[model samples]
Target chain A: MAHDTTIQTAGHDEHHHESPVVFGFWVYLMTDCIIFGTLFATFAVLRNQFNGGPNGHQLFEIGGLALETALLLISSITYGFGMIAAHKNEINKVIVWLGITFLLGLGFVGLEVKEFIGLIHEGAGPDRSAFLSAFFTLVSTHGLHVSFGLLWILTLMVQLAGTKTIPERMMSKLTCLSLFWHFLDIVWICVFTYVYLASMI
Target chain B: MSEHNTTSSGESHGSVSSYIIGFVLAVILTVLSFAIVVTHSLSPSATILTLSLLAIIQVVVHLHYFLHMGGHSEHRWNNICFVFTIGFVSIVIIGTLFVMNNAAVQMMSR
Candidate 1:
Protein backbone atom coordinates (compact mmCIF):
# COMPACT_ATOMS: atom_id res chain seq x y z
CA MET A 1 0.00 0.00 0.00
CA ALA A 2 2.87 2.40 0.77
CA HIS A 3 4.51 1.51 -2.54
CA ASP A 4 1.28 2.09 -4.39
CA THR A 5 0.92 5.51 -2.83
CA THR A 6 4.45 6.39 -3.86
CA ILE A 7 3.77 5.35 -7.44
CA GLN A 8 0.61 7.43 -7.61
CA THR A 9 2.37 10.46 -6.21
CA ALA A 10 5.15 10.06 -8.69
CA GLY A 11 2.69 9.90 -11.57
CA HIS A 12 0.96 13.03 -10.36
CA ASP A 13 4.23 14.85 -10.08
CA GLU A 14 5.20 13.78 -13.58
CA HIS A 15 1.99 15.10 -15.02
CA HIS A 16 2.30 18.32 -13.09
CA HIS A 17 5.81 18.91 -14.29
CA GLU A 18 4.95 18.38 -17.92
CA SER A 19 5.68 21.39 -20.10
CA PRO A 20 3.02 24.04 -19.76
CA VAL A 21 4.41 25.87 -22.75
CA VAL A 22 2.28 24.15 -25.35
CA PHE A 23 -0.84 24.42 -23.25
CA GLY A 24 -0.21 28.07 -22.59
CA PHE A 25 0.40 28.71 -26.26
CA TRP A 26 -2.87 26.98 -27.13
CA VAL A 27 -4.69 29.34 -24.80
CA TYR A 28 -2.97 32.27 -26.41
CA LEU A 29 -4.07 31.10 -29.83
CA MET A 30 -7.67 30.86 -28.65
CA THR A 31 -7.59 34.42 -27.42
CA ASP A 32 -5.91 35.70 -30.55
CA CYS A 33 -8.51 33.97 -32.67
CA ILE A 34 -11.23 35.73 -30.72
CA ILE A 35 -9.55 39.05 -31.33
CA PHE A 36 -9.36 38.47 -35.06
CA GLY A 37 -12.83 36.99 -35.00
CA THR A 38 -14.22 40.22 -33.60
CA LEU A 39 -12.42 42.17 -36.29
CA PHE A 40 -13.83 39.85 -38.93
CA ALA A 41 -17.32 40.38 -37.59
CA THR A 42 -16.82 44.13 -37.72
CA PHE A 43 -15.54 43.93 -41.27
CA ALA A 44 -18.51 41.84 -42.31
CA VAL A 45 -20.93 44.43 -40.93
CA LEU A 46 -19.18 47.47 -42.37
CA ARG A 47 -17.97 45.92 -45.62
CA ASN A 48 -20.78 47.24 -47.71
CA GLN A 49 -21.33 50.50 -45.85
CA PHE A 50 -18.79 52.36 -47.94
CA ASN A 51 -20.54 55.64 -47.08
CA GLY A 52 -20.46 57.02 -50.64
CA GLY A 53 -16.81 56.27 -51.20
CA PRO A 54 -14.82 53.45 -52.80
CA ASN A 55 -15.82 49.90 -51.98
CA GLY A 56 -13.79 46.69 -52.03
CA HIS A 57 -14.22 46.37 -55.75
CA GLN A 58 -12.63 49.76 -56.26
CA LEU A 59 -9.87 49.50 -53.68
CA PHE A 60 -8.49 45.97 -53.56
CA GLU A 61 -5.65 44.75 -55.76
CA ILE A 62 -5.78 41.00 -56.21
CA GLY A 63 -2.33 40.83 -57.71
CA GLY A 64 -0.74 42.47 -54.72
CA LEU A 65 -2.74 40.35 -52.34
CA ALA A 66 -1.54 37.23 -54.12
CA LEU A 67 2.04 38.28 -53.64
CA GLU A 68 1.44 38.89 -49.97
CA THR A 69 -0.11 35.45 -49.68
CA ALA A 70 2.90 33.83 -51.31
CA LEU A 71 5.25 35.60 -48.98
CA LEU A 72 3.35 34.46 -45.92
CA LEU A 73 2.92 30.94 -47.24
CA ILE A 74 6.61 30.57 -47.90
CA SER A 75 7.46 32.00 -44.54
CA SER A 76 5.27 29.41 -42.93
CA ILE A 77 7.17 26.68 -44.77
CA THR A 78 10.44 28.13 -43.59
CA TYR A 79 9.15 28.11 -40.06
CA GLY A 80 8.41 24.43 -40.52
CA PHE A 81 11.96 23.90 -41.57
CA GLY A 82 13.11 25.72 -38.50
CA MET A 83 11.08 23.34 -36.39
CA ILE A 84 12.54 20.39 -38.19
CA ALA A 85 16.01 21.66 -37.52
CA ALA A 86 15.13 22.24 -33.93
CA HIS A 87 14.02 18.64 -33.67
CA LYS A 88 17.26 17.44 -35.19
CA ASN A 89 19.21 19.56 -32.75
CA GLU A 90 20.86 21.34 -35.65
CA ILE A 91 21.25 24.78 -34.15
CA ASN A 92 22.76 26.34 -37.24
CA LYS A 93 20.03 25.01 -39.50
CA VAL A 94 17.43 26.21 -37.05
CA ILE A 95 18.89 29.68 -37.08
CA VAL A 96 19.17 29.74 -40.85
CA TRP A 97 15.56 28.65 -41.35
CA LEU A 98 14.41 31.16 -38.80
CA GLY A 99 16.37 33.87 -40.59
CA ILE A 100 14.70 32.96 -43.84
CA THR A 101 11.33 33.00 -42.13
CA PHE A 102 12.07 36.41 -40.69
CA LEU A 103 13.17 37.84 -44.02
CA LEU A 104 10.08 36.55 -45.76
CA GLY A 105 7.90 37.94 -43.03
CA LEU A 106 9.64 41.28 -43.38
CA GLY A 107 8.97 41.21 -47.09
CA PHE A 108 5.30 40.63 -46.40
CA VAL A 109 5.16 43.62 -44.10
CA GLY A 110 7.05 45.80 -46.56
CA LEU A 111 4.58 45.09 -49.33
CA GLU A 112 1.64 45.72 -47.03
CA VAL A 113 3.10 48.99 -45.85
CA LYS A 114 3.69 50.05 -49.42
CA GLU A 115 0.14 49.19 -50.30
CA PHE A 116 -1.18 51.20 -47.36
CA ILE A 117 0.97 54.19 -48.28
CA GLY A 118 -0.24 54.03 -51.84
CA LEU A 119 -3.83 53.87 -50.66
CA ILE A 120 -3.40 56.85 -48.37
CA HIS A 121 -1.71 58.80 -51.12
CA GLU A 122 -4.62 58.07 -53.43
CA GLY A 123 -7.12 59.24 -50.75
CA ALA A 124 -8.34 55.73 -50.01
CA GLY A 125 -7.17 55.85 -46.41
CA PRO A 126 -9.10 54.12 -43.67
CA ASP A 127 -10.96 57.33 -42.87
CA ARG A 128 -12.09 57.77 -46.47
CA SER A 129 -14.55 54.86 -46.53
CA ALA A 130 -16.18 52.41 -44.19
CA PHE A 131 -15.03 49.54 -46.36
CA LEU A 132 -11.51 50.87 -46.22
CA SER A 133 -11.82 51.17 -42.47
CA ALA A 134 -12.90 47.59 -42.13
CA PHE A 135 -10.28 46.47 -44.61
CA PHE A 136 -7.50 48.24 -42.77
CA THR A 137 -8.60 46.93 -39.41
CA LEU A 138 -8.86 43.31 -40.55
CA VAL A 139 -5.68 43.24 -42.58
CA SER A 140 -3.60 45.36 -40.26
CA THR A 141 -4.62 43.36 -37.25
CA HIS A 142 -3.03 40.32 -38.91
CA GLY A 143 -0.03 42.41 -39.80
CA LEU A 144 0.32 43.47 -36.21
CA HIS A 145 0.38 39.84 -35.15
CA VAL A 146 3.13 39.14 -37.65
CA SER A 147 5.06 42.08 -36.33
CA PHE A 148 4.74 40.80 -32.82
CA GLY A 149 5.82 37.38 -34.03
CA LEU A 150 8.93 38.85 -35.57
CA LEU A 151 9.80 40.55 -32.34
CA TRP A 152 9.25 37.33 -30.47
CA ILE A 153 11.56 35.45 -32.83
CA LEU A 154 14.25 38.07 -32.42
CA THR A 155 14.04 37.77 -28.69
CA LEU A 156 14.24 33.99 -28.89
CA MET A 157 17.25 34.17 -31.14
CA VAL A 158 19.06 36.31 -28.65
CA GLN A 159 18.07 34.08 -25.78
CA LEU A 160 19.30 31.05 -27.69
CA ALA A 161 22.69 32.52 -28.41
CA GLY A 162 24.28 30.57 -25.61
CA THR A 163 21.49 28.31 -24.43
CA LYS A 164 21.28 24.61 -25.14
CA THR A 165 18.56 23.31 -27.43
CA ILE A 166 16.78 21.01 -24.99
CA PRO A 167 16.80 23.33 -22.04
CA GLU A 168 13.35 23.69 -20.60
CA ARG A 169 13.32 27.45 -20.77
CA MET A 170 14.41 27.69 -24.38
CA MET A 171 12.14 24.88 -25.47
CA SER A 172 9.18 26.54 -23.84
CA LYS A 173 9.93 29.77 -25.62
CA LEU A 174 10.33 27.99 -28.92
CA THR A 175 7.06 26.13 -28.50
CA CYS A 176 5.21 29.34 -27.76
CA LEU A 177 6.82 31.12 -30.68
CA SER A 178 5.96 28.25 -32.99
CA LEU A 179 2.32 28.48 -32.02
CA PHE A 180 2.39 32.22 -32.58
CA TRP A 181 4.00 31.98 -35.99
CA HIS A 182 1.58 29.32 -37.15
CA PHE A 183 -1.41 31.19 -35.77
CA LEU A 184 -0.49 34.22 -37.83
CA ASP A 185 -0.35 32.10 -40.93
CA ILE A 186 -3.79 30.73 -40.26
CA VAL A 187 -5.22 34.20 -39.75
CA TRP A 188 -3.65 35.40 -42.99
CA ILE A 189 -5.46 32.70 -44.92
CA CYS A 190 -8.80 33.92 -43.63
CA VAL A 191 -7.87 37.51 -44.37
CA PHE A 192 -6.74 36.68 -47.87
CA THR A 193 -9.96 34.88 -48.65
CA TYR A 194 -12.64 37.03 -47.08
CA VAL A 195 -11.03 40.43 -47.29
CA TYR A 196 -9.07 40.28 -50.51
CA LEU A 197 -11.02 37.79 -52.56
CA ALA A 198 -14.42 39.00 -51.42
CA SER A 199 -13.39 42.61 -51.86
CA MET A 200 -12.36 41.99 -55.41
CA ILE A 201 -16.03 41.48 -56.05
CA MET B 1 16.40 14.71 -23.44
CA SER B 2 13.41 12.40 -23.57
CA GLU B 3 11.27 15.12 -25.07
CA HIS B 4 13.94 15.79 -27.66
CA ASN B 5 13.94 12.16 -28.67
CA THR B 6 10.18 12.13 -29.01
CA THR B 7 10.22 15.20 -31.26
CA SER B 8 13.02 13.78 -33.34
CA SER B 9 11.02 10.60 -33.84
CA GLY B 10 8.03 12.66 -34.87
CA GLU B 11 10.13 14.10 -37.65
CA SER B 12 10.68 10.63 -39.04
CA HIS B 13 6.97 9.95 -39.10
CA GLY B 14 6.51 12.12 -42.20
CA SER B 15 8.65 11.76 -45.28
CA VAL B 16 10.65 14.62 -46.82
CA SER B 17 9.00 13.97 -50.15
CA SER B 18 5.63 14.77 -48.61
CA TYR B 19 6.79 18.24 -47.65
CA ILE B 20 8.01 18.91 -51.17
CA ILE B 21 4.71 17.73 -52.60
CA GLY B 22 2.79 19.98 -50.25
CA PHE B 23 4.97 22.94 -51.18
CA VAL B 24 4.45 22.34 -54.89
CA LEU B 25 0.72 22.05 -54.45
CA ALA B 26 0.60 25.28 -52.48
CA VAL B 27 2.53 27.15 -55.15
CA ILE B 28 0.25 25.79 -57.84
CA LEU B 29 -2.88 26.82 -55.96
CA THR B 30 -1.51 30.31 -55.40
CA VAL B 31 -0.67 30.75 -59.07
CA LEU B 32 -4.06 29.45 -60.06
CA SER B 33 -5.78 32.00 -57.82
CA PHE B 34 -3.74 34.74 -59.47
CA ALA B 35 -4.59 33.50 -62.93
CA ILE B 36 -8.31 33.45 -62.18
CA VAL B 37 -8.26 36.99 -60.84
CA VAL B 38 -6.11 38.44 -63.63
CA THR B 39 -8.00 36.83 -66.48
CA HIS B 40 -11.35 38.08 -65.22
CA SER B 41 -12.95 34.87 -66.32
CA LEU B 42 -15.79 35.08 -63.85
CA SER B 43 -18.41 37.62 -62.76
CA PRO B 44 -17.87 39.56 -59.54
CA SER B 45 -19.82 37.25 -57.30
CA ALA B 46 -18.48 34.21 -59.07
CA THR B 47 -14.96 35.49 -58.78
CA ILE B 48 -15.33 36.12 -55.08
CA LEU B 49 -16.80 32.70 -54.52
CA THR B 50 -14.19 30.85 -56.55
CA LEU B 51 -11.20 32.69 -55.18
CA SER B 52 -12.36 32.35 -51.60
CA LEU B 53 -12.82 28.63 -52.12
CA LEU B 54 -9.34 28.36 -53.50
CA ALA B 55 -7.94 30.33 -50.60
CA ILE B 56 -9.59 27.97 -48.15
CA ILE B 57 -8.07 25.04 -49.99
CA GLN B 58 -4.67 26.63 -49.81
CA VAL B 59 -5.11 27.12 -46.10
CA VAL B 60 -5.90 23.46 -45.60
CA VAL B 61 -2.87 22.53 -47.57
CA HIS B 62 -0.67 24.65 -45.36
CA LEU B 63 -2.27 23.43 -42.15
CA HIS B 64 -1.88 19.81 -43.07
CA TYR B 65 1.56 19.90 -44.61
CA PHE B 66 3.27 22.71 -42.81
CA LEU B 67 1.73 22.61 -39.38
CA HIS B 68 1.09 18.89 -39.09
CA MET B 69 -2.07 19.68 -37.16
CA GLY B 70 -4.18 16.54 -37.43
CA GLY B 71 -3.09 13.34 -35.79
CA HIS B 72 -4.30 11.09 -33.00
CA SER B 73 -2.97 12.24 -29.65
CA GLU B 74 -3.67 14.53 -26.78
CA HIS B 75 -2.83 17.27 -29.25
CA ARG B 76 -5.80 16.20 -31.33
CA TRP B 77 -8.03 17.66 -28.68
CA ASN B 78 -6.22 20.92 -29.05
CA ASN B 79 -6.90 20.93 -32.76
CA ILE B 80 -10.59 20.23 -32.18
CA CYS B 81 -10.74 23.08 -29.71
CA PHE B 82 -9.08 25.35 -32.20
CA VAL B 83 -11.59 24.38 -34.88
CA PHE B 84 -14.53 24.93 -32.56
CA THR B 85 -13.26 28.34 -31.58
CA ILE B 86 -12.89 29.33 -35.21
CA GLY B 87 -16.39 28.05 -35.96
CA PHE B 88 -17.89 30.00 -33.08
CA VAL B 89 -16.11 33.11 -34.26
CA SER B 90 -17.39 32.63 -37.80
CA ILE B 91 -20.93 32.35 -36.51
CA VAL B 92 -20.61 35.53 -34.51
CA ILE B 93 -19.12 37.36 -37.48
CA ILE B 94 -21.74 36.29 -40.02
CA GLY B 95 -24.69 36.68 -37.67
CA THR B 96 -23.68 40.09 -36.40
CA LEU B 97 -23.04 41.33 -39.90
CA PHE B 98 -26.43 40.17 -41.09
CA VAL B 99 -28.27 41.78 -38.20
CA MET B 100 -26.36 45.05 -38.40
CA ASN B 101 -26.69 45.31 -42.14
CA ASN B 102 -30.45 44.93 -41.85
CA ALA B 103 -30.59 47.54 -39.12
CA ALA B 104 -28.53 50.00 -41.13
CA VAL B 105 -30.66 49.45 -44.21
CA GLN B 106 -33.83 50.06 -42.20
CA MET B 107 -32.41 53.21 -40.67
CA MET B 108 -31.40 54.58 -44.03
CA SER B 109 -34.86 53.97 -45.51
CA ARG B 110 -36.57 55.84 -42.73
Candidate 2:
Protein backbone atom coordinates (compact mmCIF):
# COMPACT_ATOMS: atom_id res chain seq x y z
CA MET A 1 0.00 0.00 0.00
CA ALA A 2 2.84 2.44 0.83
CA HIS A 3 4.60 1.57 -2.42
CA ASP A 4 1.48 2.25 -4.38
CA THR A 5 1.08 5.72 -2.82
CA THR A 6 4.75 6.57 -3.59
CA ILE A 7 4.32 5.60 -7.23
CA GLN A 8 1.13 7.62 -7.48
CA THR A 9 2.81 10.63 -5.87
CA ALA A 10 5.68 10.38 -8.34
CA GLY A 11 3.20 10.40 -11.20
CA HIS A 12 1.54 13.53 -9.84
CA ASP A 13 4.93 15.23 -9.50
CA GLU A 14 5.81 14.46 -13.08
CA HIS A 15 2.52 15.78 -14.27
CA HIS A 16 2.96 19.24 -12.71
CA HIS A 17 6.70 19.48 -13.42
CA GLU A 18 6.60 19.12 -17.18
CA SER A 19 4.39 21.62 -19.02
CA PRO A 20 3.66 19.80 -22.26
CA VAL A 21 0.27 21.43 -22.36
CA VAL A 22 1.66 24.88 -22.87
CA PHE A 23 4.26 23.56 -25.25
CA GLY A 24 1.62 21.83 -27.30
CA PHE A 25 -0.37 25.04 -27.49
CA TRP A 26 2.74 26.85 -28.64
CA VAL A 27 3.15 24.38 -31.44
CA TYR A 28 -0.44 25.00 -32.45
CA LEU A 29 0.27 28.72 -32.61
CA MET A 30 3.24 28.08 -34.86
CA THR A 31 0.91 26.32 -37.26
CA ASP A 32 -1.26 29.43 -37.15
CA CYS A 33 1.80 31.43 -38.18
CA ILE A 34 2.14 29.37 -41.33
CA ILE A 35 -1.49 30.00 -42.15
CA PHE A 36 -1.07 33.75 -41.85
CA GLY A 37 2.11 33.53 -43.89
CA THR A 38 0.32 31.95 -46.83
CA LEU A 39 -2.43 34.54 -46.65
CA PHE A 40 0.17 37.28 -46.70
CA ALA A 41 1.78 35.74 -49.74
CA THR A 42 -1.53 35.62 -51.54
CA PHE A 43 -2.14 39.27 -50.74
CA ALA A 44 1.25 40.30 -52.02
CA VAL A 45 0.73 38.52 -55.31
CA LEU A 46 -2.66 40.07 -55.98
CA ARG A 47 -2.19 43.48 -54.36
CA ASN A 48 -1.50 45.28 -57.60
CA GLN A 49 -4.16 43.57 -59.68
CA PHE A 50 -6.63 46.40 -59.15
CA ASN A 51 -8.54 45.68 -62.34
CA GLY A 52 -8.98 49.35 -63.26
CA GLY A 53 -10.33 50.07 -59.81
CA PRO A 54 -8.91 52.17 -57.00
CA ASN A 55 -5.53 51.02 -55.76
CA GLY A 56 -4.32 50.71 -52.17
CA HIS A 57 -3.04 54.26 -52.11
CA GLN A 58 -6.58 55.43 -52.67
CA LEU A 59 -8.29 52.82 -50.56
CA PHE A 60 -6.18 52.62 -47.39
CA GLU A 61 -6.47 55.39 -44.85
CA ILE A 62 -3.31 55.67 -42.80
CA GLY A 63 -5.06 57.57 -40.02
CA GLY A 64 -7.65 54.87 -39.44
CA LEU A 65 -5.04 52.13 -39.57
CA ALA A 66 -2.95 54.04 -37.06
CA LEU A 67 -5.91 54.09 -34.69
CA GLU A 68 -6.48 50.38 -35.18
CA THR A 69 -2.83 49.66 -34.49
CA ALA A 70 -2.97 51.69 -31.32
CA LEU A 71 -6.03 49.81 -30.11
CA LEU A 72 -4.51 46.37 -30.73
CA LEU A 73 -1.13 47.26 -29.25
CA ILE A 74 -2.67 48.60 -26.08
CA SER A 75 -4.84 45.52 -25.80
CA SER A 76 -1.74 43.34 -26.03
CA ILE A 77 -0.22 45.12 -23.04
CA THR A 78 -3.46 44.89 -21.08
CA TYR A 79 -3.58 41.16 -21.71
CA GLY A 80 -0.03 40.91 -20.47
CA PHE A 81 -1.11 42.59 -17.28
CA GLY A 82 -3.92 40.08 -16.98
CA MET A 83 -1.41 37.26 -17.35
CA ILE A 84 0.75 38.75 -14.64
CA ALA A 85 -2.26 38.92 -12.38
CA ALA A 86 -3.12 35.33 -13.18
CA HIS A 87 0.39 34.31 -12.20
CA LYS A 88 -0.08 35.88 -8.81
CA ASN A 89 -3.38 34.09 -8.44
CA GLU A 90 -5.09 37.42 -8.06
CA ILE A 91 -8.29 36.36 -9.69
CA ASN A 92 -10.06 39.67 -9.34
CA LYS A 93 -7.22 41.64 -10.85
CA VAL A 94 -6.95 39.13 -13.62
CA ILE A 95 -10.58 39.54 -14.52
CA VAL A 96 -10.35 43.30 -14.40
CA TRP A 97 -7.35 43.50 -16.65
CA LEU A 98 -8.83 40.99 -19.02
CA GLY A 99 -12.04 42.96 -19.04
CA ILE A 100 -10.11 45.98 -20.17
CA THR A 101 -8.37 43.90 -22.79
CA PHE A 102 -11.70 42.64 -24.06
CA LEU A 103 -13.07 46.11 -24.52
CA LEU A 104 -9.97 47.21 -26.39
CA GLY A 105 -10.19 44.15 -28.58
CA LEU A 106 -13.84 44.89 -29.21
CA GLY A 107 -12.96 48.39 -30.25
CA PHE A 108 -10.43 46.98 -32.71
CA VAL A 109 -12.91 44.63 -34.35
CA GLY A 110 -15.51 47.37 -34.45
CA LEU A 111 -13.15 49.67 -36.29
CA GLU A 112 -12.23 46.94 -38.73
CA VAL A 113 -15.86 46.20 -39.43
CA LYS A 114 -16.58 49.86 -40.00
CA GLU A 115 -13.69 50.10 -42.39
CA PHE A 116 -14.93 47.07 -44.33
CA ILE A 117 -18.37 48.58 -44.58
CA GLY A 118 -16.99 51.85 -45.79
CA LEU A 119 -14.85 50.11 -48.40
CA ILE A 120 -17.80 48.18 -49.73
CA HIS A 121 -19.85 51.32 -49.88
CA GLU A 122 -17.07 52.94 -51.88
CA GLY A 123 -17.34 50.11 -54.42
CA ALA A 124 -14.10 48.56 -53.14
CA GLY A 125 -15.93 45.32 -52.44
CA PRO A 126 -14.07 42.02 -52.63
CA ASP A 127 -15.84 41.09 -55.85
CA ARG A 128 -14.71 44.28 -57.55
CA SER A 129 -11.14 43.19 -58.22
CA ALA A 130 -8.51 40.62 -57.37
CA PHE A 131 -6.71 43.25 -55.29
CA LEU A 132 -9.86 43.96 -53.30
CA SER A 133 -10.53 40.27 -52.78
CA ALA A 134 -7.07 39.56 -51.42
CA PHE A 135 -7.10 42.68 -49.29
CA PHE A 136 -10.46 41.87 -47.73
CA THR A 137 -9.49 38.25 -47.16
CA LEU A 138 -6.20 39.02 -45.42
CA VAL A 139 -7.44 41.86 -43.24
CA SER A 140 -10.77 40.24 -42.40
CA THR A 141 -9.00 37.01 -41.48
CA HIS A 142 -6.99 38.88 -38.83
CA GLY A 143 -10.14 40.57 -37.60
CA LEU A 144 -11.83 37.19 -37.31
CA HIS A 145 -8.97 35.93 -35.17
CA VAL A 146 -9.37 38.90 -32.87
CA SER A 147 -13.09 38.27 -32.60
CA PHE A 148 -12.44 34.65 -31.68
CA GLY A 149 -9.94 35.81 -29.11
CA LEU A 150 -12.57 38.05 -27.55
CA LEU A 151 -14.87 35.06 -27.24
CA TRP A 152 -12.07 33.06 -25.66
CA ILE A 153 -11.51 35.82 -23.16
CA LEU A 154 -15.17 35.74 -22.16
CA THR A 155 -15.10 31.97 -21.74
CA LEU A 156 -11.98 32.14 -19.61
CA MET A 157 -13.53 34.80 -17.46
CA VAL A 158 -16.55 32.61 -16.86
CA GLN A 159 -14.26 29.79 -15.84
CA LEU A 160 -12.30 32.03 -13.55
CA ALA A 161 -15.47 33.30 -11.90
CA GLY A 162 -16.17 29.81 -10.64
CA THR A 163 -12.86 29.55 -8.76
CA LYS A 164 -11.49 31.54 -5.87
CA THR A 165 -7.96 30.31 -6.38
CA ILE A 166 -6.52 29.75 -9.81
CA PRO A 167 -5.59 26.11 -10.37
CA GLU A 168 -2.63 24.87 -12.37
CA ARG A 169 -5.00 23.88 -15.13
CA MET A 170 -6.47 27.34 -15.38
CA MET A 171 -3.07 28.97 -15.31
CA SER A 172 -1.87 26.89 -18.22
CA LYS A 173 -5.02 27.68 -20.12
CA LEU A 174 -4.53 31.40 -19.53
CA THR A 175 -0.96 31.16 -20.68
CA CYS A 176 -2.08 29.64 -23.95
CA LEU A 177 -4.60 32.41 -24.45
CA SER A 178 -1.98 35.00 -23.60
CA LEU A 179 0.31 33.61 -26.25
CA PHE A 180 -2.51 33.67 -28.77
CA TRP A 181 -3.25 37.31 -28.03
CA HIS A 182 0.34 38.46 -28.37
CA PHE A 183 0.77 36.41 -31.53
CA LEU A 184 -2.16 38.23 -33.11
CA ASP A 185 -0.55 41.57 -32.29
CA ILE A 186 2.67 40.49 -33.97
CA VAL A 187 0.76 39.44 -37.07
CA TRP A 188 -0.97 42.80 -37.11
CA ILE A 189 2.40 44.50 -37.22
CA CYS A 190 3.12 42.62 -40.40
CA VAL A 191 -0.30 43.40 -41.79
CA PHE A 192 -0.02 47.12 -41.20
CA THR A 193 3.46 47.20 -42.62
CA TYR A 194 3.00 45.02 -45.69
CA VAL A 195 -0.61 45.87 -46.49
CA TYR A 196 -1.13 49.50 -45.52
CA LEU A 197 2.29 51.11 -45.16
CA ALA A 198 3.81 49.34 -48.13
CA SER A 199 0.82 50.27 -50.23
CA MET A 200 1.33 53.95 -49.58
CA ILE A 201 4.93 53.65 -50.67
CA MET B 1 -1.62 37.35 -0.73
CA SER B 2 1.43 35.80 0.87
CA GLU B 3 0.45 32.41 -0.47
CA HIS B 4 0.23 33.77 -4.01
CA ASN B 5 3.40 35.82 -3.82
CA THR B 6 5.48 32.81 -2.85
CA THR B 7 4.85 30.96 -6.12
CA SER B 8 5.41 34.06 -8.22
CA SER B 9 9.13 34.17 -7.56
CA GLY B 10 9.75 30.88 -9.39
CA GLU B 11 7.73 31.59 -12.49
CA SER B 12 9.14 32.99 -15.74
CA HIS B 13 6.26 35.38 -16.19
CA GLY B 14 7.85 38.80 -16.57
CA SER B 15 7.31 41.85 -14.41
CA VAL B 16 5.33 44.99 -15.09
CA SER B 17 8.43 46.97 -15.99
CA SER B 18 9.21 44.68 -18.88
CA TYR B 19 5.73 45.00 -20.31
CA ILE B 20 5.82 48.76 -20.00
CA ILE B 21 9.18 48.97 -21.72
CA GLY B 22 8.00 46.82 -24.55
CA PHE B 23 4.88 48.93 -24.97
CA VAL B 24 6.86 52.15 -25.11
CA LEU B 25 9.28 50.80 -27.66
CA ALA B 26 6.46 49.46 -29.80
CA VAL B 27 4.65 52.78 -29.68
CA ILE B 28 7.78 54.62 -30.77
CA LEU B 29 8.42 52.25 -33.63
CA THR B 30 4.82 52.55 -34.75
CA VAL B 31 4.84 56.33 -34.68
CA LEU B 32 8.13 56.44 -36.53
CA SER B 33 6.77 54.24 -39.29
CA PHE B 34 3.79 56.52 -39.72
CA ALA B 35 5.93 59.62 -39.64
CA ILE B 36 8.24 58.29 -42.32
CA VAL B 37 5.36 57.62 -44.63
CA VAL B 38 3.57 60.85 -43.85
CA THR B 39 6.57 63.08 -44.36
CA HIS B 40 7.88 61.20 -47.38
CA SER B 41 11.29 61.91 -45.89
CA LEU B 42 12.98 58.98 -47.58
CA SER B 43 12.98 57.89 -51.20
CA PRO B 44 10.31 55.35 -52.12
CA SER B 45 12.58 52.30 -51.84
CA ALA B 46 14.20 53.64 -48.70
CA THR B 47 10.82 54.31 -47.08
CA ILE B 48 9.65 50.78 -47.67
CA LEU B 49 12.92 49.34 -46.39
CA THR B 50 12.80 51.44 -43.25
CA LEU B 51 9.16 50.52 -42.59
CA SER B 52 9.99 46.82 -42.96
CA LEU B 53 12.92 47.13 -40.57
CA LEU B 54 10.77 48.82 -37.95
CA ALA B 55 8.14 46.13 -38.26
CA ILE B 56 10.75 43.42 -37.77
CA ILE B 57 12.05 45.13 -34.65
CA GLN B 58 8.55 45.46 -33.20
CA VAL B 59 7.97 41.74 -33.82
CA VAL B 60 11.13 40.89 -31.88
CA VAL B 61 9.99 43.13 -29.04
CA HIS B 62 6.62 41.39 -28.89
CA LEU B 63 8.27 37.97 -28.97
CA HIS B 64 10.62 38.76 -26.13
CA TYR B 65 8.55 41.01 -23.89
CA PHE B 66 4.96 40.13 -24.65
CA LEU B 67 5.30 36.45 -25.57
CA HIS B 68 8.12 35.84 -23.06
CA MET B 69 10.16 33.85 -25.58
CA GLY B 70 13.45 35.44 -24.62
CA GLY B 71 16.48 33.09 -24.68
CA HIS B 72 15.29 31.28 -21.51
CA SER B 73 15.79 27.55 -21.43
CA GLU B 74 12.07 26.82 -21.10
CA HIS B 75 11.49 28.59 -24.41
CA ARG B 76 13.98 26.40 -26.25
CA TRP B 77 11.48 24.37 -28.19
CA ASN B 78 9.24 27.35 -28.65
CA ASN B 79 12.07 29.37 -30.12
CA ILE B 80 13.19 26.50 -32.29
CA CYS B 81 9.66 26.05 -33.57
CA PHE B 82 9.31 29.75 -34.19
CA VAL B 83 12.56 30.00 -36.12
CA PHE B 84 11.62 26.95 -38.11
CA THR B 85 8.21 28.36 -39.02
CA ILE B 86 9.76 31.67 -39.97
CA GLY B 87 12.12 29.89 -42.35
CA PHE B 88 9.28 28.20 -44.19
CA VAL B 89 7.11 31.31 -44.09
CA SER B 90 9.88 33.39 -45.58
CA ILE B 91 10.40 30.84 -48.30
CA VAL B 92 6.74 30.80 -49.18
CA ILE B 93 6.20 34.55 -49.25
CA ILE B 94 9.42 35.39 -51.06
CA GLY B 95 9.13 32.52 -53.54
CA THR B 96 5.56 33.33 -54.45
CA LEU B 97 6.39 36.98 -54.96
CA PHE B 98 9.40 36.15 -57.09
CA VAL B 99 7.66 33.63 -59.33
CA MET B 100 4.48 35.66 -59.72
CA ASN B 101 6.30 38.91 -60.38
CA ASN B 102 8.53 37.26 -62.97
CA ALA B 103 5.60 35.60 -64.67
CA ALA B 104 3.72 38.86 -64.78
CA VAL B 105 6.68 40.65 -66.29
CA GLN B 106 7.17 37.95 -68.91
CA MET B 107 3.52 37.84 -69.83
CA MET B 108 3.21 41.60 -70.01
CA SER B 109 6.28 41.88 -72.21
CA ARG B 110 4.84 39.35 -74.62
lDDT of 2 by residue, A1-201 (tens): 222332332232232442789999999999999999999999999888888999999988998999999999999999988977675567899999999999999999999999999999999999999999999989999999999999999999999986888877888889889999999999999999999999987
Tell me the lDDT of model 1 at A78: 78
Model 2 docking tier (incorrect/acceptable/medium/high): acceptable
lDDT of 2 at A156: 94
Per-residue lDDT of B19-107 in model 2, one digit per residue for the tens?
A: 88889999999999999999999999999899999999999988878887765565678889989999999999999999988998889
* Residue pairs of candidate 1 with colliding backbone atoms: none
What interface Cα RMSD is found for model 1? 8.2
C-alpha local distance difference test of each model: 0.72, 0.85
In candidate 1 the C-alpha lDDT for residue A192 amounts to: 73
Stretches off by above 4 angstroms in model 1 are A1-18, B1-15, B105-110
Scored by lDDT, model 1 comes in at 0.72
**A61-103 per-residue lDDT for model 1 (tens digits):** 8868878888988887777667655644567777788888888
Q: Give the true-contact fraction for every prediction, in order.
A: 0.42, 0.73
